[model samples]
Target: MNSNIDLKELWAKQETGIPDTKDLVKRVASFKRAHLKQVIYANILLLLVAVFIVLVWYYFQPEYITTKSGIVLIILAILAYLFSYNQSIPLLLKSSYEMSSADYLQQLLSLKRKQQFLEGIMTNLYFILLSTGLFLYMIEYTMRMKLPLGIFCYGITAGWIAFNWFYIKPKTIRKQREKIDGLINKFHLLTEQLTEKK
Candidate 1:
């Protein structure tokens, strides 16, 4: 009984390392701003690339229905991705300062779910559309070129696309999930510490 009391006293005196509410709020706000900027930059870059691809199709005019259909599908895919991205950004960037800790936590969880859905389902769809589009687009182009040159071009494009889809994209998604989960945990701990009796 005496040891238990001493342990309690010791724990009470220990610095928990959890920042005060205001500091935590500030930190979270800062993270939100940075994250929002990254999202916006990525979206804008992708939108520009999509436009560039469409422009190329309009000007160069690949000589097959498949090529035209491919370009259209690629445009559709990018637009769909952009729409989903825009919808989720507002949910993620809404200020949490005015919210109670519980509400804020709930918001974070919802944002995480939305992110997972986007990264998992939407990302896969985007890549599928991209691959199929490129394949269809290449059909006519490949026929006009020398056999060796055509093989080389197809081989390089396929390799690069495979590398991005199988490696880089999944790695990026995993890192994002980890970062969000870490933030959620930190906020959870901070809230618990703040609410606990000394």
Candidate 2:
């Protein structure tokens, strides 16, 4: 008796289809090898820049560094940069498998999901850098108790960020929504593959 098996039927029950595990692992491995090198190098550069900023701030403004706030912010900046740098590129690199068949396509799509997550993480890291820079500049003026042009520049920068965030954040959210859709599509494929394998 030949009973036609449609694995996709099972996948339809779930929100995201589970693809064949064999293809999943191999696809992830292959992607990591091809994509991570440049991304890692870029992150390393960002880390170096963060380190340089810390050194410069410490060297030039030892007198102004009475409060621990500036120091804490600097440390936080360094940490955020390092985290994004380490987490994303390595995640990308981990996808170094062979995608010989379409089986791995599901896993590759999952990798894209992780990549989107990394994008959010990196976005936060960049925000930290921007906020810290503004805080430090403001503190410098506040410490001296002097009203100067530099203070005005900082205020303007803050206002600009606020304005852009107010307007631009929605656009960013929309883009993220698209990424989510892409992820879902890939997941569906994965599920289809899994059902077939079964």
Candidate 3:
């Protein structure tokens, strides 16, 4: 009876270091809202760009088959990316409040996995299609220009694409990964604490 009392006293005194449940839930909900906003903004921007491209194609009416093919490819790339990216919306829309901690953790893990696939394979595919489309699309316009002007145009475009692929993309992916990973780690710690309490 003395030892039991001592154990209970020690347990009561020890710092579990777990955050308040309400606070944790609030943080998770905040992240979800932020993520949803990001997705919405991205989708809107991409759709606007696609519409602009279609208008350009319709108005300009390029003579070259290559230019037409390039337009098609660019539009396809955007659509395919949007399709894949939007797949996460349903998962994101599910309320965290309705889920058990373990279930929520599993959802987060699944989200992380989906994000990895998007950032990895889907990203590569999008870039490849976009680059190829741009190159092809530029050919007819560049051919009509003087040699020096054509060279300059190609050079500028290539440099911009290279910068986006090499620098901007990696930085964006790193930031996104850090945000999601941080949330996953927090939930993991929470789950561990809950398990210990039992």
Candidate 3: give the clashing pairs: none
Residues 1-198 of candidate 3: C-alpha lDDT, one tens digit per residue: 899999999899978677889998999999889988988998999999989989989999999988888888898789878876886556556547578877777677677666666656666777778888898889999999999999999999999989978997788777767877787787678778768788
- Estimate every model's Cα lDDT from 0 to 1: 0.80, 0.65, 0.81
Cα lDDT of model 1 by residue, 123-159, tens digit: 6787778888887888789989999999999999899
lDDT of 1 at 147: 99
Once superposed on the true structure, which residue ranges of model 1 sit more than 4 Å away at CA? 1-44, 95-99, 187-198
Each candidate's TM vs. the true structure?
Answer: 0.66, 0.54, 0.69
How high is the lDDT of residue 38 in model 2? 65
Off by over 4 Å in 3: 1-44, 95-99, 194-198
Query: In angstroms, how far off is 42's CA in candidate 2?
Result: 1.2
Global local distance difference test of model 3: 0.81
Best by TM-score: 3
Per-prediction RMSD in angstroms? 6.7, 10.0, 6.2
Arranged by TM-score with the best first, the candidates are 3, 1, 2
